[model samples]
Target: MTQKEPAGSVAAVAGDKSSLLTMDFREKSWIKVQKKDGSVIAEYIGKPGEQRQLEINEPVTIIVGFAPGVTMAFRGNPVDLAPNTVNSVARISLK
Candidate 1:
């Protein structure tokens, strides 16, 4: 059996700001945006700034295959990618 590599995770703190996620892809990259329930919202290898801003009423989880050229912010705050910078991939929970 082939085992998948473990992914890094970061949680978004509950705050007063609206549940808005802003994604700016500076390069072509693969990304999966989903709700916490595992329902996928968007998944694709998109061009720069392809998915500008997504408004989800609930929390979401995003798995980014390439982190360097992607910019993601939730609730007006930037999601920290430093924790998984070396891994080249990040699994973030915007909950």
Candidate 2:
């Protein structure tokens, strides 16, 4: 017979498991990451055409301030952000 793990016993592991998110800032803008409790985890101001890389964790939120010409990509996938508006990327849970 095969053994089965206990219920709720398998803990979530974050061991070297991360996704690369690259932001190509075409204009000046503020980028930040927050938790569910409204706590800021990471924040920064990106320059024009600046390339930024972030190793993202699970169950977090990403907030981007209004800025035109700013674009983002996760795992080489383009992320669409509205212009001149506050954008929030939430519920980013990675297994």
Candidate 3:
């Protein structure tokens, strides 16, 4: 859940129930989350220091435009941003 969406910020979901993904942005960046069927959950240019928690209920793809200052936790555990990063972007598939 998010508290606010300033201009240029986007966070949404088509449906939900059980799974979860949380993001904490330490710097300005772009972020998008999508379900397996390609439906967008959240898509936005995040302001620095913003944090979001998504209740996924299933697996999803998360795209991070600037990997350098973003951290994520899935199902209450911290995720390793390495191994999936390229050119400062990260395309992570989480369940």
Candidate 4:
């Protein structure tokens, strides 16, 4: 018979399991947001010179909606996007 592991015991044994979870949303390597032309937008990290790889026809979440208007959201967190801008996807890097 197989013995059940205690609660969180497995995670305890794993080294720096905190890396698996982060409170820093800025560290996320992905961007999901709508575009200026009303097209869905998605991008993946790309080569040094190449533009981010875009995924067409994918539904993107509106970061502006997270707060209020585009202006407000940007003003609230310029890190997310430029102030007064609408429907744009920006890649955030953490290094």
Candidate 5:
């Protein structure tokens, strides 16, 4: 039987600052995205960020496999947050 990966809240930590105007972090979450046959296609860390500041250790819902982005509360609508040099870790859930 194929083993299914556990799904839950993943925490991403800030790695390094991208630029003077932008911040960046390293994805600490191990996310495996597959197509069919459970074959791993793309694997990356799913983290959320905004502007040039990412509220590290903050709990935010990261929607994966939709677009090259993340989700955030923007004016009562789900917005896609793209990865940028200024992008930083928004939240880190408690254990």
Candidate 6:
């Protein structure tokens, strides 16, 4: 019997002042973005091989569910996350 594997790892990429943030994943998962005050900024479900863009103005925390073949990039730059990671969180500051 083949055991069903859990979601894969999470990756992140941040954008600069003149660019928009982008995230890409290979599996279905939930994404959440929050501010320093714990207020949610953005939340949504992502599809496989999906790419999302966001415009942030302050420091925020990003939370993503682990899914197989997940990857992320910010402003066209790749952000590295732990391999085979579970639910992950990334803090970003746009100053």
The lDDT leader among the candidates is 3
Candidate 1: the clashing residue pairs are none
> Best-fitting candidate, measured by TM-score?
3
Worst 10 residues of 2 by lDDT: 86-95
> Distance (Å) between predicted and true CA of 94, model 2?
8.3
Q: Each model's TM-score? A: 0.68, 0.63, 0.75, 0.20, 0.22, 0.63
Give one digit per residue, the lDDT tens place, for model 6 in 5-95. 3566122224443345677867777777788898998986888867888876556776666634456665456656564355554434432
Quality of model 4 by C-alpha lDDT? 0.31
Q: How does each model score on lDDT?
A: 0.74, 0.61, 0.78, 0.31, 0.33, 0.62
Candidate 1: what lDDT?
0.74
Of models 3 and 6, which has the larger lDDT? 3
Q: 1-95 in candidate 3: lDDT tens per residue? A: 84564676333444432245777889988888999999998897777889887776557888899988888887567888878999999999875
Report the Cα lDDT for residue 33, model 2.
Answer: 75
Q: Write the per-residue lDDT of candidate 4 for residues 1-95, one digit (tens) a residue.
A: 95565775332122333212121232323334555565645433322233222222222334322222122122122334444344443333211
Per-residue lDDT of 85 in model 3: 94
State each candidate's clash count: 0, 0, 2, 0, 7, 5
Native-to-model Cα distance after best TM-score fit, residue 49 in candidate 4, in Å: 1.2
Q: Ten residues in a row with the worst lDDT in model 1?
A: 8-17
Candidate 4 versus the native: TM-score? 0.20
Runs with alpha carbons beyond 4 Å of true place in candidate 2: 1-18, 83-95
Model 2 lDDT per residue over 1-95, tens place: 95554685333333432356777888787887776677876888888978887765545577676445567776456665653254433233221
- After superposition, which runs of candidate 6 have C-alpha atoms over 4 Å from their true positions? 1-17, 67-69, 83-95
Better of 2 and 3 by TM-score: 3
